[model samples]
Structure formats: structure tokens, C-alpha cells
Target: MAFDGTCVACLVHELKEQLLNGRIAKIAQPETDELLLTIKSTSGQKRLCISASASLPLIYLTDSNKPSPMTAPNFCMLLRKHISNGRIVDIYQPKLERIIHFTIEHLDELGDLCKKDLIVEIMGKHSNIIFCNENGMIIDSIKHVSAQMSSVREVLPGRDYFVPDTMEKSDPLSVSESDFIELLIKRNMTLAKSLYTSFTGVSPVAAEEICTLSGIDSYLSPKELSGDTFKHLYNQFTIYFSAVKEGRFSPAIYYDGKEPKEFSALPLTHFGGYTRKEFSSISEVLETYYASKNTITRIRQKSADLRHIVQTALDRNKKKYDLQLKQLKDTENRDKYKVYGELLHTYGYNLEPGAKKLEALNYYTNEMITIPLDHTKTPQENAQRYFDKYNKQKRTFEALSKLIQETQDDITYLESISNALDIALTEDDLAEIKEELINAGYMRRKFTKKKIKIKNKPLHYISSDGFHMYVGKNNLQNDELTFHFAVGNDWWFHAKGTPGSHVVVKTEGQELPDRTFEEAGRLAAYYSKARGSEKVEIDYIEKKHVKKPNGGKPGFVVYYTNYSLMIDSDISQIQELS
Candidate 1:
């Protein structure tokens, strides 16, 4: 959520609850811009990870620890020298800004007690971890910014440390209703935009939530709102922030079918359609959300080469298929040539010598027709020449018809591979896909002394009616699930006429319920290429009715008799087995 001020406030609240009066046990610098601090509080030992990365700045408590570098960085050593064993006296956020101040009391070089401020600013690219003396003079910062870097403020030693007030936003925690309405009314923008731009900690999502709670349109400008509507919005806004002030947070991650869409420290009622998975703490929310996001991003990056290979082959086959279809169209006139030969043979004897053309009646259509003849050749020879031309085109048509089907098959197979890449979630999935490509002759097989083992498995889910449903992640797995794993009485499902996973419901010789069928259909639609469509057509039949053609590609099957269902790709209600 952009690491907005509200999130900072949430983290600060969590830190105060866990780390107040805690003694710093250990300090480690795993990355140049990151620090892992071990603290001993009343509850237990906790690890606090703080990162001032330019791209992703974060501060959260985590159970996982990272390997530290052999030599400490200058910033890490400086922090350890002064505040290594310091007691955290206080922890607070400044006026709802995206900044946290940790007051630490430690003994000076002469054994005298002194306090220092370890400030963590969660601003986007300007994020920094600064160590300051009691009087707010910067001792050193993890990141150094000179005057040339930023004209607003320089984060260097001996500089007075302060939070930049460039945005000039009001503190939502302290602002009154009159001030809120007056500030919002002055901005000529949408209500949602006005709220975030006017307040320090209000994000766009938070603003939208406030508008939703107040039954007001967030798209409307402040000028369009009546006085009573403004009062209602302000009331909702106060109620929203009061939770933060009172530490009544409900941390959750909202998901759209298994993918995390958004996270919030407070409940986001506007996103009621999403699947909400609440966490006991905001730290869990941050860890799970970012970990899932990183997995998705990493898999995508790893599959780029496979995607390119599949796409290149698909494009080539598609172009070849188009050309073959056009060539086949030209052979459509082969029958006309045959008719011309017959007409010439029937009326050739009556033609005058050196005649350029012969006019005759066609017996096939019982109509008058014209046939061109060679002036130097006899009529019989001309007829024979036409017969040869007809034979050649007939042969061409037959060859092109067979070639066109093969080209079409190649195109479909390549498209299925592309779809497989889309649904691949791990390295093993990609390895299986790469092996398929190598076997299909689209890629060269890399030789190795030892065979690599692939542990990829089909996605398993339990239907609402206590039935088991299995979804194939790739063509190999699809073939295995349908032909080998499922029994004759099992139900088979797939997206109609599209590249998708094969869903098999193990009925165990029992008649399936209607709800099980619908749930299985949803799984088929969700795992297929047409995942986001509102309604997808699914074909279902018994495993005995589904047949795989001899010498056909993997995952290719045909069923003559099957039932069809039009269902959506939403599988949020379905329970998946990990």
C-alpha cells in the first residue's frame, strides 16, 4: 500500500507494544541498506528488520533471519558503537508522518547515561535510517545525500535532522472537522483525491473506504457535496483514524482467487467481494503479502526464456498455417479444369484448324461453355494438355489439405505450451515444460550425466460436497491425471475449445452432486487460459467417455458425449490442499 503514513503508524504501534524498554541484544547488517536488530523485551526475544531500500522500504518484525556480511558496514559499526546495548526508552511516530523515532538510553564513553534517536523514515526514494544525538544532530545516516542530490534536505553528519514538510498535509489525527472540511473544499479535485492530498496519513484506499462508509460518491468534487454530506464524511474519517489512535487494527490481506490483491491495517469494507484472510498482527500481513508477491514476480522472470521460445514457435506456425490455407483456396478451381478438359474432348473434332478457342456444351452442368486451345497442337493434344493440368491441380489440392491440418495442429500445440507457461508457479513446472519442448523438437535437449527429478504435482482441491478434484498444471500432468490417475467412473472437465487444465473429479463410483460439478467447473475455468472471463463454457464427461487419439500430443483428448456448464473463474470459496 505504498508504505503510507497509516501503515507506518500501525508498525509503530506494534513496535511500542513489543519493544518498549527492551534491551538491544545484537545488531547485524545483512545488506548495505538493511539492518536486523535483536531485542530482549518482557514478552520474549524479537527480531526487528529495517530496510531503507530505495525501491522497497520496509520495517517489520520477522522470525526469519538473514546471513550477515563478514565485515560490518560503516553505518552498522557506528550504530553498534553507540546504541549496541541501549534500552529502548520510547517508540513513537511523528504526527502520523511516515517516520518512526526510537529513543534509546545508553552509557556514554565515560559510563554516563545519554539518550539517542534512531530515526527510520519510510519515504519512498528518500527513505533513510539516521542515528542522532539527544539534541537531534545527525551523527551519520545509512544513506548520504549531498546538497546537489536534494535541495530540500541533506542527510549527513552534523546536519540538523528533521522531517521534510514539502507536502504541507494536515495531520489527520489532530485536525478538527471544520479544518478538514475547509481544507477539502479549497481543493478542486475528486473527494478521494482531496482527502489524501489534504491529510498526512490518508491513502487513496483509506479515502475510498471513508466515502463508502459515509454513503458518498468518492468521485464527486467537494463543491458538489452539501454541508450535511461533508459532516458525514468527516465523521467517518474521524472514526477511521480513531481506530489507529486506539490501537484497534484489523490486519488482513485481500485475495482475488489465490492471488493477493491488496492489504490493509484496517478493514477495507469496500472490497467486500474479495476473499479476506485476516492476520493476528500486521507483521504477518506484510510478510505473507510480500512473500507471495515476490514468488509471483520471480516465477515470471524465470519463465521469460520459455515464454519467448513458445511464442516464437507459435508465431511461425501461425504464419505457415495462414499461407497454407491461402494455397488451398487457389486449388478450389481444380474441378473447373477437369470440366474444361471433358468439354474440349467432346467437341474437339468439330473445331476448325488453327482455331484459337472451341465453343461447346458441358455435359456435367448441361450448359454452353468455352475452352481455350493451343493453335499449333491438334485438338486431341490440346484436350490431353488440359487433362494433365487438371490432374496436377487435383494432386496439389490433396497435398495442401493434409499439410494444412498438420500446420494447424502445430499452432494449437504451441498455444497450449504458452498457456502452460502462464500457469507455471515453480522451477519444477518450468523444467517439465522445457522437457516437453525438447521432446517436441522445438528445443535442443541439454545432456547431463544424471537425470533431473521433477516433483511437480497437479493442484488438489476438495469440492464442497466432499469430493476430490485434481487440476493439471501442464500438459504432462494433464495426461497423467486423465488417463492414469482417474478411474473409469470419474468425471472429467475442461474448458470448451480452449487451452486449459484438465479437471478430474474422483467420484469413487458414486453419483456426483450438482454443487460438486459446479465447483469442478470453476477449477477448470480458473486454471485455463480464459481465467478472468465472466462466463466460461466447460465440457464434462465420464473418464470412460474421454479418449486420447493415437500419436496425439500430450493433454489432447476427445469426447463425443458430455454435459456443458457455463460458470465463472472465481474459486475463492473452494478449499485447496497444499
Candidate 2:
């Protein structure tokens, strides 16, 4: 997960734009380093995600993603005690320095209105989630930055705090063209490198985008820029700043084919062809991608043994078939030899039947051999016995042929089912697929006769355009959605060639708008194990082509001629169903 400071900036901007005046409805710390803030915005309730993890620290507004632990972590409990029901008074970013401050107003122990400042510094290793009193006295923090850790300032209790200094750099959002050029020249680097490194809060990618818009090479030396060139660059930078203020988010994922790719946008060229997606914010990207990945991982963890069981059965059967095939081949040689023996006995008198000094001609290979058989038996009797031997050998071949065919068929069937599992999306879908394995004797059935209590169907989301989308939780639910619930015109989607749940978008005979398709694709991609991947391939097709074989595993199906899209594994755009 690329939980960079840029992602944190995007989240802060989103909260200020879409959820500025929203009240803090609920707060929960589901993990040691994570917080889920449920806010009641004018549009609807939204969940904002914040984390101060040593591995990954970022703050983003997420629509749908799995919470970390079922039990609350200690940090979460501490946060709930200090900040519950705290109304957000203000949300501000500190000059694009990868930090966001939320001024929350609440009643103190004496029931008087008190204000607390929650500062989120998203500076990678320096990231901290701090809670302070109105006087800037540190109350508690997700992480404590002691004096020993940093020369700047301590984040311990009772310390008077202030935001970190940006040293000598001018704020990119407000600096004059001459100042910008002066800072760039002092850096003595490429235009892309200079702007990102010199400016307070200017990401390398965003800086390069400015150069791109101005028709200037990002690799050009900053010292080579003329006065007019500097002015042109500044104007382009301003355009982007204004665009961000207007909420124009270009959500994207960079990858090399099937694997996720990561790079700092500071060197824009390194982030090649980062396809802009249909998402509105970074949180949407995190939610969809991570949630899908979580589901896939969970199912894989749960069904690890079932997969092993089926594979073991397959290996055992394959070996049996190989041995039987070899035996059949050897029997053919034995039968032919027996026939040769009988022929030699019957035709011995015509050749050199019992004469040790004479060799008889071999009928099959034209080799000469001395025939020693019953002396009283005529050549005619021996010939009749050879014919009988030939007939018996042919019968054995016929018997073994049927057995070999059955074993090969079994191998083919089991392999097909395993391939279907690779594309399963949800645990329920896996459950359905597992049933098929059990029924075929590849696995043992545990819930043979117990009545299964059906939970409510997976959460449903209605798009802004009013299209209904249904997400399946497991294979049994997938079967229900595709076969019994969905209409013919409904669109079906799944993570291409991976285990994931089926996502169905009901058009209701209504033609799907393009946004709806992208949104649905994002959901499908997000719900698979590949969700955090740079690009998760999604398979989309009309509901009509999907079919479950009789007694097939749950969520297993056969379909062809589907459209595929490479999408980022984030589903933050669609509002989750309550």
C-alpha cells in the first residue's frame, strides 16, 4: 500500500471540500494505529480513515474497507476517551507540508466548551497523530516524538507545541515567480527536481505536471530557464493549485502489467502512463483496493485446506491412471507373444515342429525359431489354438480401454473446477465452489444436512445516476444473484483470473451509463485480493452468459466473450449501503 504524504494531502482536501461542516457522529479506533471517524455530512454520513502506522501513515476519507481488528486496540480506547463527540470546528492543511490540522470543539469535564487541535503530520517516518489542548499543550499522541528522536520539537505530554518549520522554502501556493525561480536556481537541479525539493509542500509529480503544461522539459536545467520561461512555469503551477481547490482529483495507479508499481511523483517520468481513473478521491482508491484484497486473503486463509484436499485427490488419481496405462501397454506385448507360441505349435509339422536341427519361420516378425509342441497334435490343431489366443488378447485391450478413459475424464473435470476457484471473489462464492468439490468426493462434506440460515444479501449501493448495484458475499450468494435475482440485462463483474466475489449492477433494462460501468468495475476490482495491486484486471459481461454446472461448486461458472478493463483496485466512489 503506497500510503504516502501525497495521499494524505488528497484526503485532507477531500474532507475540507465534501465534508467540511460534517459533525463527528462517531469515532472508533479499530486498530492500534488506525481510526475510523464516522461523520454526518450534508450529503450523507462518511467514514474518514486515519492511520499513524510505522509501516504506513496516511489520512484519507474511505467509503468501504474492512476495519483492522474486531477488538479495539489500546490507542483507540484512549482516543475514544479524549475525543468522543468532538465537533469539528475547522479543518486546515499547513501550507501543503504534508500536514493537516483539525480544530475540534467539545465540552470539557466541567461542561464548558473547549477546543482541541488534532494535528496529523503526514511526513512519512515523521508522521504523528497529535492531540493538544487549546494552549498548544500536548495531551496525547498516536506516537510520541521525544527530544532524542528529533532536534526540532518533542511531542511528549505537557510540551508546548508548534508546527515544524519548513526552513527557508517559500510556500508553492503563494510564492512569486522570481522567488520560485530563485529557489529553483539555488537547488541547481533539473526543473522537476528543483521545484519539488525547494518548495514547501510541492510534490515532485505535481511539479513535473507544471513543467509539462508549460511545454518545458522536466529534465531541463533550472539555470537554463529564461525569465519568460519561469513565468510560464509559475502560471501552470497556479492552474493546478486552482484545479485542486475545485476538487479535480485524478486518481490513478501505476503498475507493470499485473503487478503494482510504486514511485515518487517528484520524478514524473518514472510514473509512466498512470492511467487516470473514475474515482473522485484517494480514499476511494484505498477502500476499494484494500477491501477486495482483504476478502480474497481471508477466503484463501479459510479455504487453504480445502484446496489442498482437492489437489491431493487429483495427484492420487493421476498416478493411478498412469500406472494402469503402463500395465495395458505391457499386456498387449504379452498377448501377441502368446499368439506366436500357439502358431508355432500348430504349424510345426509344416515347418520343423520338433526337430532340434531345424528352425521354423516366425509369422509376426519373419524370424526363424525351432517349434517344440505336442508331437501328437496335428498342425491344424495348433493353428486353431493361435487364433483363440489372438481373440483373448483383443478382449483384454477392450476392457482396459474403458478404465483408462474414465480416469482421464476425472482428471480433466477436477482441473476445470480448480481453475474456476482462481476466479472466485467472496467466501460465500468459495463456499458454493467448495460444495462442488465435496459432492465430487474430492473433499468431505461437513454441512451435509444442516439447514443454512441465510444472512441478509450483500450491501447494495445506488449510484448517483440511480443504478442499483449488488455485491455478492459468497459463492452461494453469487449463484443466487446471477441465476435467480439478476435480470438478463444486469451487468456482471469479477476480478479477472482471481478469486473474488461477483458484483452485479442492475440496469433494470436501463442502458448503463459509462460512469456506472467504471464505478461497478472499481467495486469488482476492489473486492478481490488484487485490490491493492496497481492494476486489477476486471472481467465484465452481461448476466446471460454466466452458468453454473449441475452440482458445480458455489460461485463457479462458465462464460466466454466478456469485456475486460484494467482498473485501480479502489471503490471509494460508491457509497456503501447502510
Candidate 3:
């Protein structure tokens, strides 16, 4: 979900309650587009994080602190010089806009009392944090926006700081029922579209919720609605905003299985089927949602180079493997050449002089066959020529068979590396994968005087039946968990004929329950390359039955006997230990 106007309002309410009279204790710029401000309020010291990132703009109160650079940025220095130790006079949001205003009071250079506004606009792409004087003149901004960037508003220093009037949206807090219906009826758009477009803070999801509450179709245009339906919609809209007006917010994140799907300032009836995890404050909701999203996004960004390397190698190996198979297919007729040579040796003496061909009965099949003859060559030479052709093809077949197997193995190893990348969640996981690639000669090993050690562990989970389960994140971890970690009596599970994590369940010499097996199977399926499939076929056996070849690649094993089960890739019910 977007950091919509309703979310902004909830944040403003929470901030006012926490930091209305707080003193600016410290200021730091940990990133180019972010700021961390420590404020000493009546409650306690709290850190407020505000980011104007073009991709993910956010403002939330967090307990965690980020390390700053040795030197402060220009914007941070300017802010510290002007508003250092300033008292937060008031904190408020303007109408339903996605903006927050922090009015600070402090003594100026002349020892006279003064006020300033630190405004944070949460607009996507155009988001900015501007410091303004009492007269609303921009002093400086975290990001400088020129006239060329946005003609509607320029956020450079000394420019007039005002909210852009391009939206021309009405404040939902004061919008009357008659005005709501009349304004919406003029627009030739869907009911949901008109609500968000007509009001300052109503988002598309919130508009849908209103329509659901009023028993109206959000897709229907306001112009097509009957008078009775419009009245009902207006009634529901007022009731919905009443929570915002009264500062009654229910912050929650809805989850689709284990993944966060959407977050809302108020309970969304439309998402009733989803698992809603409520929070005591809006900041908690924003922090949790964005933190989870950022972790996944950051890991992907960091793993891009590794992914590119793995994919390139995989593609090259796959093409080579295909060509090798085609070449191996051509060697199938080598046996036919051998038969021709044997037939020639038996019947060459019977050929006439200057004969172009020889017809002989193939004793093996009792069938007549014609053999082409080099007329200039003697019968002995012709027979030797056929024998030479057969010997060359026989040698070619032998070489190609070995080459094809090696190429096929290379393709498999590269694919497993690719799958490992897909499941990588941290830099440590990536480091382990990179080590594997370097060891396999796919990547060049870096020469360093001091060796850097990476400690990466497999995922641990507790099944419903109190059984301990472990899932490998990458090939290296898979090998460690399957061999060194598990005893002979422990159970092992893996996705059948696919690149995936090896799942191990420690039995401790007790009988296994069906529930534990199913849970472990889900983990094996979820961490594997076949994740998100409706059902995955899994092969399971005792650790004693799973044997790694003496020179096999990491995670490669042979199991002659195992049980197979079809299980889904859902691990939401499984409890994982961090």
C-alpha cells in the first residue's frame, strides 16, 4: 500500500502525541536522502526517521539508529546551525495532504524568539524536506527542485514554500454531503476514482472500502448512481473520515500467507480474508512494513552483480550442453560404419575389377546390402579404408559421450547457483554463494592477504509436533546440513529432480509424526526453485541412505531408496526461529 493521506494523518496524530513539545537533541544524515532526528520529549528520547527517497519516501519513528558519516552533509549542517535545540512548538498535517509541518521555537542570534517550519512532503518522486522561515520562504531543502524539474513548484533556497494547487482537491474533513454528491456527479469517472480524485486524502483502497460499506459498486460512475445510492455513499464517506477527524486510528498490516500484502491506517473491510496484524501505533506499522520490503529489495539490489554472473554462466553452459547433445546424436551411426567394414572384409575378394559397388548378403540380418567402392583402390585398400572410417567414428563417439556428461553437469551446477541467488536474503548468504562460484572456477578468486570468514547458517524451524527442522539456504549450507549436521537416524528431504534446499529433520531416535513430515516437506518445497508451485514432489529418506559421491559437487547426492510425497510450498504455519 502507498503512504496515502490517511496514513499521513495517522502519523501526524501519533507524532503530535509523542513529540509535540520535544527538543531537538541531535541531528544526523545517515543517507543522502534521509535524516534521523533525536528528540527529547516528555515521554522519552525518540528518534524520528524521515526519508525523501524517490523510490521509497517514508517518515516513521524508530528505536533503531543508523551510523552517520564522519562529516555532516551541507543540509544537515544548515539544519543544525538554525534549529539546533529548538523546541517543537507544534506538529500538524495540513488538511488531508500528504505533508507534515513541524513548527519550532528558538532564540535567534539577536536573542529574540523566532519560529520556523520544517515541512516534509511525502509525494512520490517529488518528495522533499524543506526548512522555511516564519514568512514561508524556503531556507533550504534536502533535495533541490529547479523550475525545469517541476514548473508548479521550485524548492530551492529563498523560493516561496507553498503546497502546489494542481490537485484542486477538496478537504474531506469539511466536505459537506451535498457538495460531495454534487462535485462527484459532475465527474465522468468511476465511483472509486471520483472519491480519491475529488477528496484530498481518500485513496483508491479507502474509496473502495467506502463503497463496500455503502453497498455500492465502486466501478459505477457517480453520474450513473441513483439519488438514494449517492446519499448512502455520502453517509459512509462521512463515517469513514470521522475516525480521522477524531484521531481514532487502527494501524494494521494485512498479510497474504506470510508475506505482507497491504497496510492501512484504518481496518479495511475489503481485506477481511487476509490475516490482519494490528499495531499500537502507525509508526510501528510503517516501520515493520517498509523494513520487511526494504530487506528484500536491498538484498536483490546487492545480489544483482552475482545474479548477472550466475545467469550468464548458466546460459552459456546450457547452450553448450545442447550442442554437445546434438553432436552425440550424430555418433549413433558409428555402429553402422563398423558393420559396413566387416561386410567389406568378407566380400571384397569377390568384387570384379573396376567395380563401382559390391552386393553382399549381410549374414547378421540375412539381407542383401550394397557397398560403395573406390574403384581405383584395391580390395584390401578399400576394406582398410572402411575400417579406418569406422575407427575414427568410434573414437569420436567415445570422446563426445564424456564431453556431453561434463557439459550437462556444468549446466546443472550453474542452475543450482541461480536458484541459490533467488533465495538469498542477506549479504552473508550472497558471500557464501560467491565463494561457491569462485571454488567452481565460474568466478575469479580474489587475492587478499587476510582471509575473510563468512558464517552462514541454514534456516531453523520447529514443527507442530515439536520436531526440529533445518533448511539449507544455498549449496554450501545444504552440504553442511545434510552431512556434518545430521546423524544417520535423522530424516532428509529434497525437491525431486529440481534445484532446491535440502531439508533435514532431527528425530533424536524417536518415531516421526506425520505432521512433522508434512511441515518439513513444506519447508523443502518453499526454499527450492519450485517455490510458489501448487504442489511439489519431494523425495525423503534417512540420512544414512543419502550419500554424496566422492567427487560430487556441493549439494549433489545419490539416494537409491526414498519415499515420495506431493506437498505444497506453504510454510506459513511453520514456526521459524531467527
Q: Candidate 3: deviation at residue 36, Å?
A: 4.2
Best model per TM-score: 3
lDDT of 3 at 293: 68
Candidate 1 lDDT over 520-546, as tens digits, reads 999999988899999999999999999
Q: Model 1, residue 226: displacement in angstroms?
A: 10
How should the candidates be ordered by TM-score, best one leading? 3, 1, 2
Q: Write the per-residue lDDT of candidate 3 for residues 476-532, one digit (tens) a residue.
A: 999999999999999999999889999999999999999999999999899888999
lDDT of 1 at 365: 82
Error of 2 at 332 (Å): 7.1
State in Å the error of residue 544, model 3.
1.7
Q: CA lDDT, every prediction? A: 0.90, 0.70, 0.90
Give the TM-score (vs. native) of candidate 1. Answer: 0.72
The parts of candidate 2 lying over 4 Å away from their true place are 1-10, 13-24, 28-35, 40-46, 49-78, 87-90, 94-171, 174-205, 219-224, 238-422, 425-427, 434-578
Query: Model 2: how far is 455 from its true place, Å?
Result: 6.6
